[model samples]
Target: MPDNVPMEQAAILADAVSTPFGAVVHTEVRVGESVGVRGAGGVGTHVVQIARLVGATPVIVMDVNDEVLQRSLDLGADHAFRSDDPALQAKVAEKPYLNRT
Candidate 1:
């Protein structure tokens, strides 16, 4: 996560799409670490930043667009890849903080 990134948008999207009853998007891991989270849209750009605030170092972002991938890298992703990659799950798994769900 980059410094000064806000998480409000991700909080809204996660609740709108997956969580019930307007939940808090932030999650704390059992291992006492916060995971890098990429928002599905433009909002995702912020998720990576906020993840850093919560303690994920060297944030990684996920996107299908090449430009967005580049922007994400510019925003401070230590590394990044397309969500559409054939080996997407494998690549994600390579990150210590992000394994296949």
Candidate 2:
């Protein structure tokens, strides 16, 4: 644990960040790569930040909740979409930046 982090917050912080950090590391996300996270809850939110921290570009988030989607954007996601949208796939496909050849 870092000296800057308060002890009271350590466990919660680790629990929140560990899985996402591991997942991002395990996937070997490269700089400038586009990342799409499929949820916007606790773990998903952390994934967005970790991806961004590792230099992933155009980090996109998908979730059913409008508030959660917006929150993802605020947290570091370049784009957010409602998973329940019937046009979600089309919308994502239309984003030219996401379709790197």
Candidate 3:
């Protein structure tokens, strides 16, 4: 852990940081790439930040909660939407790199 970081924060960092960091590294996320996170809870929130940290463009995050979706935007996501939005599929389809599945 870095000396500047608080121990309490550092302790949870491993849990909150590892998965997203590993996924970004292993996926070889390149600059200008697009990233989509399906959930906006603990893990999903970190994924948004990690994707932006790695220079991903149009980081889209989806969740059922409006507040969580907004939080994703506050963090780093370029787009936020409810999972059950009537136009969700259409909106996603319009994005060039967003995988359907």
Candidate 4:
């Protein structure tokens, strides 16, 4: 957040720093590609947003927690599932390209 921005919104700086340096810089995520983030933790959550911003479709996010999985869906993931769920493999298989990292 800028010096003049609200202090409450300072959390935005997390992704503001990670999005460009981590996702966009190190990865070769292309448009129309599918992305599957294995965890919905801090970094993984940001990856979900970055993937969507770059035009990734059917963005998938997998985690052990139901709330986190749902949160990923709310954050732009097309599919969110528990990592241990047997159905996860089948769902991932359905995507044309899944950039799981």
Query: Which candidate tops lDDT?
Result: 2
Predictions in order: lDDT: 0.57, 0.92, 0.90, 0.79
Error of 3 at 98 (Å): 6.2
In candidate 2, what are the lDDT values of residues 1-101, reduced to their tens digit?
Answer: 88998887888677678989998999999999989999879889999999999999989999999999999999899999999999999999999896556
Q: Which stretches of candidate 2 lie over 4 Å from their true place?
A: 1-11
Residue-level lDDT tens digits of model 4 in 1-101: 46998876676666654663377447788888777788988778888888888888878888999999999999999988889988877877766565455
Worst 10 residues of 3 by lDDT: 92-101
Pick the winner on TM-score between candidates 1 and 2: 2
Tens digits of per-residue lDDT for model 1 on 9-54?
Answer: 5456564444411121435422234344454354566655455444
Off by over 4 Å in 1: 1-25, 29-34, 38-40, 95-101
- What tens-digit string does per-residue lDDT give for candidate 3 at 1-101? 78999999887678778988898889999999988899978888999999999999989988999999999999999999899999998988887776566
Q: Rank the candidates by TM-score, best first.
A: 2, 3, 4, 1
TM values, all candidates: 0.53, 0.85, 0.81, 0.71
RMSD of 1: 8.3
Worst 10 residues of 1 by lDDT: 20-29
Q: For model 4, what is the alpha-carbon lDDT of residue 79?
A: 88
Sort by lDDT, top down from the best: 2, 3, 4, 1
Error in Å for residue 14 of model 4:
6.5
